[model samples]
Target: MKTKQEESATDFLKLVKNMKYFTKLKSDNSNGDLFNVTLKTASYNELNLMVSCLLKASICALKNDNSGYSSASESGIDVLLLLEMALQLLPDEEMQLLDEFHKNAIDRKAEQ
Candidate 1:
């Protein structure tokens, strides 16, 4: 049987997967029915998915509370930096796409 911590970790992973899927559906202008399809394409270690989830959670927290940025304020920034660092750990094409996606997200936020 799994320990409580392990169960919690599993639950967190499921939450992240669902959150990432929902955010992608919202941003892609695609049908919500495609949420599972998009999520199926994500690997457990996918940096893009992880970063996307982090961005979504951060934005949600910022909108719902007046706590300000807190120590977690730099999470999205840290995710971007980690993606850059992960370039050495991932394939060239994967890294290139992630860079492009990151740039597009930043551009979209700037426009907003």
Candidate 2:
């Protein structure tokens, strides 16, 4: 049996795998879908999937409302915070590698 944290992580991973696009529809001029997101990693994409899952989970928590004092909202936020902390445990070099990837990605886009 899996612990709550494990279950949460698993749920997040599943969500990320099933998600194909990300967009914020705001106006009639919107293109519906914005950026093309993909995850690549040395661990057969496991690391990418984990990071993507945490990011998506955090976003989901933010989208939940607390104005009505909903318990679910609190739970969602807690999950996000915990996952963020877990990610922080990654080695500094790993985080730096992630930063480099982002920088290279932007540079590639600039050439387009």
Candidate 3:
């Protein structure tokens, strides 16, 4: 029998999937491009850490190469330092605008 916490965690994972969070994932291992493939599945603990930490790291990308998020980290390369250099190349206003646009899009979806 599963404990209540276990059940809740499972449910939470389900919710994330239902919300399309898992729909946009790209393989870090490019087909024949990279020497090794880094197939990763976020563990429950890791997901908890990410959510609790408000990770803005874009280490992960969408399967369709559309949307992504990024965050700061201490290590030169870790789970959370994605697109930092590319993001730096972007203007602050553009970032802010993108944020606002995303919010609006989500709000519109929720309204529907």
Candidate 4:
């Protein structure tokens, strides 16, 4: 059986593939999704900078939430949801490392 990480990796790949088609579709706004356009047009360095900013934001969000894992805080859940989206922007190796870290965190929470 595939490990959870393995399944997650597979699912991530599928989502990336699906995003290609979604990107092709026209948005309701005439501007046509500025974020999507930026992602498509940005240089490698620009994209890297954007991802770094997102990581910083996620860290700040995570740090602001004080509630212990046993009792989920609204902010904690929001941070996790944001982190999930941020994970998609990361390179595979970094993504895997973060993914493992998150899994370990959840496992530790379950132990408490």
TM-score of each: 0.24, 0.33, 0.26, 0.37
Off by over 4 Å in 3: 22-25, 31-112
Query: Could you give candidate 3's per-residue lDDT for residues 16-105 as a string of tens digits?
Result: 978877544444554644243233436745544544443344423322133323322322335434443333333477568889999999
Model 4 spans with C-alpha error above 4 angstroms: 1-38, 67-77, 93-112
Worst 10 residues of 4 by lDDT: 32-41
lDDT of each: 0.60, 0.64, 0.53, 0.68
Candidate 2 local Cα displacement, residue 85, angstroms = 3.1
Counting clashing residue pairs in each candidate, in order, gives: 0, 0, 6, 0
Deviation from native of the Cα of residue 92 in model 1, angstroms: 1.4
Model 2: per-residue Cα lDDT over 3-101, one tens digit each: 999999998888876884333333344465543334345683576567677777765665554444455455746765757654753457876898999
lDDT of 4 at 91: 69
Please identify model 2 stretches exceeding 4 Å from their true place.
Answer: 1-44, 66-80, 89-91, 95-112
Residue-by-residue lDDT tens digits, candidate 1, 7-72: 999999899898874464443346645333233335636755665665666556555445664534
RMSD of each: 16.9, 18.8, 18.9, 20.4
Highest TM-score: which candidate?
A: 4
Q: What's the lDDT of the predicted structure labeled candidate 3?
A: 0.53
Q: Model 4 compared with the native: what TM-score?
A: 0.37
- 2 against 3, candidate with superior TM-score: 2
Candidate 3, residue 69: CA error in Å?
Answer: 32
Error of 3 at 17 (Å): 0.6
